[model samples]
Target: MKAVALYGTIGSLVLTALAAVPAGGLTRPDTAGAGTPAPAPPRIAFGRCAPVERLPSSVECGRLTVPLDYAHPRDRQITLTVSRARATGGPKVRQGALVFNPGGPGASSMHFPMYGKTERWRKTARAYDFVGYAPRGVGRSAPLSCQDPAAYAKIPSASPREPSAAFKRQKYAEAKAYAEGCARKAGPALRHFTSANNARDLDMLRAALGEKKLTYMGASYGTYFGAVYATLFPGHVRRMVFDSVVNPDPRQIWYRNNLDQNVAFERRWRDWARWVAKHHKVYRLGTTPQQVLRAYDTVRARLGHRPLAGKVGSAQLQAAFLKTGYNDAYWPVRAAALSAYVKGNPKPLLRQTLPQPGGEAADENSNAVYTAVECNDGPWPRDLRVWDRDNTRVARVAPFETWDNAWLNLPCAFWPRHAPRGASQDPARFATDVTDAALPQAGAAHRPVDVRTAPGALPPVLLLAAERDGATPYPGAVELRRRLAGSSLVTERGAGTHGVSFGTNTCANQYVERYLLTGRTPARDAYCAARAEPKPVLPAK
Candidate 1:
């Protein structure tokens, strides 16, 4: 879940545009991935959240104080904002807390506990107190900020076409500047803003919540967070559901993962293009995928010449179109917008791409924390030449997002967390065989949080994945299934959406709900055919 609005590589685009852990083997430090368990904290004094939170009246919120760096639990502390909606059913039906995290290493999920209010989730709501939290370095939890909103907004967008030497230099300069800004603002604290630490914090939260075993649901990058938690506390996990899973291959952790996303996004783009083409009678964009693509290219190129109403330019065009890859729900509106633009009305496209007023701070904070988590998670290439070469190559085949994603992650090259000594930093090795069962592992310091569990060490994990998922590709679910013993995958075939279970797809949702409600899973892997694509939004003319 690393393709969000504005900034490309952070997480879910739709949520940005619009808008855990384990049971305690308490009183002890984790053997592998966490720090010493903190002392018992006070019960979360639930109260009304701010109006800005948009949480339901039943959803009460509170805060827990936790160690900023788990290694020294006695040192600097930070506040973790927590929210809860208690189980509606009687004691016989209660199953403790069921936590939710909706991707973005930076996405604030203090509002997520309210998701149970929806009809699709009401059954699970009756059985468990839906819990949500803002992880360390996110909203209301010692929020992180790297750049000035004004400065960040002014930062130039990556070129849509093949980059020239001058443009590449500009991008590197921007990346270095962005990196330096983070170092200047957040300083050494940025190192602790990591997935490993996030997992550690979740364990602390679990202990505080008094849960002996953790039951959780995560989407996109949240799956990675869950995987890390399971790796660290396998015995504490009661049940889990990962929707749109992140690939857990040590070799693909941070760098190679983005490269893989480029190819996947291109495929999803084609899927959207084909959908648009089939509706040519209404959209008039094209009658074939290639022609639809040409229409997109034409609009992008024309935007470079003249931004719509002086707001949406080529880069904005790309960002708007990028959401199409994330979910087909955006397809009709997007197709209509593009069609409108081609027909000489830029207002629809303008409405789609313009930034919301006063939302700049949230955007800046999201990008800052995203870079901090990714850069600190593992080693990235230290050299720009390496990035230039790899992104350039990927751009040839997956041009839609390759360079754009490259620019989003460029800051990693200059991040304060340097590659570990003696760790494998070869991006190429992982590129060729990312899904190989027997992958050459990186050093302990550089590898992804070791997620492999001893047989039966963990509970049955249910994976919900869309076949053509763009943000967190489908293969990630497959790899995660292999790593987590007894895990079952319910794949939504031919679907390109990022998150699956919450959508209209009853097939995938059945597996998720059943597993959450009864702790049951398919005997083996299962499949769910995706529903038909959205019909054209514009009326036939």
Candidate 2:
């Protein structure tokens, strides 16, 4: 669930008082003084946004202040940048605010609503104002910086497939250094970058928008965020759609979840290999899955020795192709790149993997925020040995992502060790603390939501995921289905794309469009047989 950005595509409510308690009665009204009404929502004066925010001119932008710590609401504040595109339909036809997050607990989502202008999304745009906001610690919303952009870009790139002991140690040191950098630069704010706070900030955004209830659409990690929102503000939810959902089981809150992603990614990697093999006439990488994999390993090994144009090393090559596991829309370009490279032309491969000068440095913010949020959200293994052992074991079977992902997350092992309440004081103990009750909160610590809400307490949510999605994986949707009793699951069978709704999967998009346009959902789980894999158009000979 970590990335620079995700593209391609890729719930109900309300009842009389006779209905069951909202959010299974788990919600707590914003803490208020006796006989005092909760505070009024902050007024967000909409106006021109800075050009750097990258929003369309027609979309207005504004900022709202929310407490850095809801527990001490008045003590510290942070700015949240929000944007809106008015519903295309008249007010009479408009539903309400439809806020969305484009995954990446760290990715900038200010431009997300712009997708509404596209034909496939025009209908949803007509029905609701397209609302978007940079979640806390992301983009223009009080952005978190842990290292100089230039320094981050220059950090030594290590091959994900390296299995040598020296490589593991090197990665451990780098992760520790990264964690230290965040703590040094971010200070107390680092500990406060929890997902629970993100959910709380979202509720405030809802109030500022003057919406009586929340209508939301989220993909990848956004689904997890939405789940936390529903758990904390069940009464405020009007409707929701969770795409490529993360599994919410306490045991897999995140650390184990990433390991799970490794196996799934390997599966998708094979899927891509098979596709390339099928199109051997075009790519000519191979004629069988095994042959294609050999071609791929050969390219990686060659890059390992002499990086293409001294930029795309084995590390960069793996990173570029990893996108294929997230969405096969990347398969053709990436497949072609490898094929061209194998045929002694490195230009296409380099084009696909090299970062523009000063571009990768900007990714520092995303990387910083991603680590801060994930580490703070729940407990991580305090011991590096635990990680090394687990990742090594998984690497044998799922080599594509195991070590790479291990390095991405190793920072959590050295995160600031002040565990939330109920954790042990020892830093190592805090890291290994697996308190089921304190799993998956948006803030410091909280219990796993009793997602089984009473009738009418929560609307029937819609969940979308490809059967073979590597990022969030398919089982997550099924597990989420079990947790959210009234929810429906739409599976795109045989597909490996992470974001499944708005891409070429017409059958899947039909469900998405229908549920968003009208609050209708299948009574039970649904399935959409996979469409044929995309055919690559060969370039002129």
Clashing pairs in 2: 9-500, 9-501, 10-502, 10-503, 12-459, 195-442, 196-442, 196-443, 197-442
**lDDT, residue 176, candidate 1:** 79
RMSD of each: 6.0, 4.8
Candidate 1 wrong stretches, greater than 4 Å = 1-23, 26-37, 155-158, 418-447, 539-541
lDDT of 2 by residue, 132-177 (tens): 8888887778889888888787722558466688877787777878
lDDT of candidate 2 at residue 476, scale 0 to 100: 85
How do all models score by TM-score?
0.90, 0.90
Which ten-residue region of model 2 has the weakest summed lDDT?
9-18
* Deviation from truth (RMSD, Å), model 1: 6.0
- Residue pairs whose backbone atoms clash in candidate 1: none
